[model samples]
Target: MTGSPEAQTSQTAEKLPLPIRLIDGLSGLSAALAAAGLVLLALNVFLDVLGRTFLHRAIPGTIDMTINWWMPMLALLAFGYTEKMQDHIKVTVLLDSLPIGLRRAIEGVFSLLAAVLLMFLAYYTWVDAARSAKIGETTSSSPPVMIWPFKFVAVAGVIVLSLQLLATAWRNFSGRLPREIDFDVDEAAL
Candidate 1:
């Protein structure tokens, strides 16, 4: 009636409740920004390498930027997108044998548990970010990039990831999200 739990896509996204849609929007936005961060990171690395090879000098704070900024941005920011796409590795061997209703219920319970755990992670991450920001942290590179601002990136990423987990829990609870996740299926089916 609602979702087949067989396929979840943007089309189904449109049918989601407002709160879920809003969360999805935020998740999508964070993911899009993460994508941009990835592009920027690649370009930054490329330029740094080129400068080192041809100009005989590496970019002043390239290492610091990569470690402090780009890597976190790329990794943390896309977490929600990964969850939303259900792209993470999952072991469904045991789940496959259960009845559809039972499977959904089990999945829903696990999603809730995972979401709760992520909430704790987000909280601790926020505390760390706040401490970093309060200290006005900076990398010890020649250019001295500010590390404090980028710390918030971690907070945002964790928050979005937790939210995405909550959304997933809700979907699973509603029994509207999935039939089976067959990793062995043909790629063309996807």
Candidate 2:
């Protein structure tokens, strides 16, 4: 005998194409960027340690370059990628206890809010980046690196995250996405 309607519903999750593929591709790109950023950060750390410990002279602006520039860039570049991979935190206490339909509704609302917030962030970051570029903002330390590039990363990440959120919302509203799409343990475990 077949199980209940809810069981049946669980068995057949409609899969949508195109948007999912696009977001997945973008997420892969974000992961690549994050890997590159980590490599750069590691190299910077290695150089700093080597110079300070053996040579007894730190690289000028190494601290400033990493903290003020590379850190922000890494964070911004990874935002969309992390979101795409569903690595963001959430208050799942309520969501877990709720029925599937109720959970979907709440997810829809949350996705909408995230989309709006990310879009706003993208807009303002772009403005800030433009202003920084125009004013020729640079690190105060020796071997100055322009600050506008980091700002651009902020803008780009937000825009990409916004696009991903929109796609998520659309999939949810259409019932193409499962209530626990973001909570799939296989992907989350990695």
Candidate 3:
């Protein structure tokens, strides 16, 4: 609360309710896993190509691993990060022109709807993951790798996203949501 909005947001996020902080920490961990997955994926592709071209023997299960595991980790794990950062694309022309109250109402409603949808997604994905684990489902690889873990990742990602959406909805309705930075507003008025 002592620093700029961005700094305050980062600080306050850490001090949020325990559940929020827990989910936030999990999101951070997911992001880290995504980063590591990216590195491993790159190395895997490189090694697979090299082995295939020169050694005439590709890395076993590279395609399946990339498609089934690495790609999901890379893509799905960033849900919370993107939501927290508000990095998702938004068509703001209409919102920007609206009255502040109306804009907040719209944002809050949308956020709530998003939260509901993500909650459903999280529930269904968790159930799917559990079913997969129970059935000992495996990827369609030569040596079929277990795939339930990736389904759990999807569940985690959606859960984090749902929490973030709920937080956004609360902030929006409460008029505590941070506004987009407008560096030129003051200067333009002057």
Candidate 4:
């Protein structure tokens, strides 16, 4: 993303190990799906409003669909991509006062710890998802809508998030992770 196509192909980024590349791809996929879901969710709500206003009839399952399907798809899948982009909110005033080496070390350790904790979370969520799948979990709309698939989406999100965290931990420990660039935008300029 930082360079032209030819530059990137010739750069060290493309040489990252296969697992790292795969995790990056997974994160990208999650982001893409989340974006697509956002579009669809907006369209769905628009249609629901249009139908009700024009025909005096509401979409039967629109509310359920929004709550069960689109919400989880958007929320759960965003974590890894955000983390990979180093876009998570940070209050670094205290860390900024620390020696660079110690700060990096602390960040690295916490990332590693978080990754481990999320692995356990992913496993537990998978177990619950499997149970939901086995039971054919669904919403109570007039026509039952399967809701279990989105449970797996949550699990995938967690797994990808943890993997990215592990990768971050590695970069942090090795001092290869660049400090995230901060951009100050003037609200009036927009």
Candidate 4's C-alpha runs over 4 A off are 1-12, 178-190
Q: How would you encode candidate 3's per-residue C-alpha lDDT over 1-190 as one tens digit per residue? A: 3678779877766556676567557777878888988999999999999999999999988988898788998988887777666677877766766777788789889999999998988888888999998998897768888787788888877887788777777767766553453322355565
lDDT of 1 at 189: 57
Q: How far is candidate 3 from the true structure (C-alpha RMSD, Å)?
A: 3.5
- Candidate 2: count the clashes: 0
Which regions of candidate 2 are displaced past 4 Å? 1-15, 174-190
RMSD of each candidate?
4.1, 6.5, 3.5, 4.2
Residue-wise C-alpha lDDT for candidate 4, range 1-190, written one tens digit per residue:
6867567544645666777667777888998999988998999999999999999987878988888889988988988888877888987767766776788788889999999999999999999999999999999778787889889999998998999998778767776553343333336866
RMSD of 1: 4.1
lDDT tens digits by residue: candidate 2, 1-190: 2887677544543344667667756756876786787888889989999999999988787777788667876887777666654667776866766776777777878888989998887898899999998999998767886777778877777777887777667666666653336442345555
Residue 117 lDDT (model 3): 90
Clashing pairs for model 2 are none
State which candidate has the highest lDDT.
Answer: 4
**Of models 2 and 3, which has the larger TM-score?**
3
Candidate 3 local lDDT, residue 111? 92
Instruction: Please report, in order, the local distance difference test score of every candidate based on alpha carbons.
Output: 0.82, 0.73, 0.79, 0.83
Arrange candidates, best TM-score first: 1, 4, 3, 2
| Cα RMSD for predicted model 2 | 6.5
TM-score of each: 0.85, 0.78, 0.82, 0.85
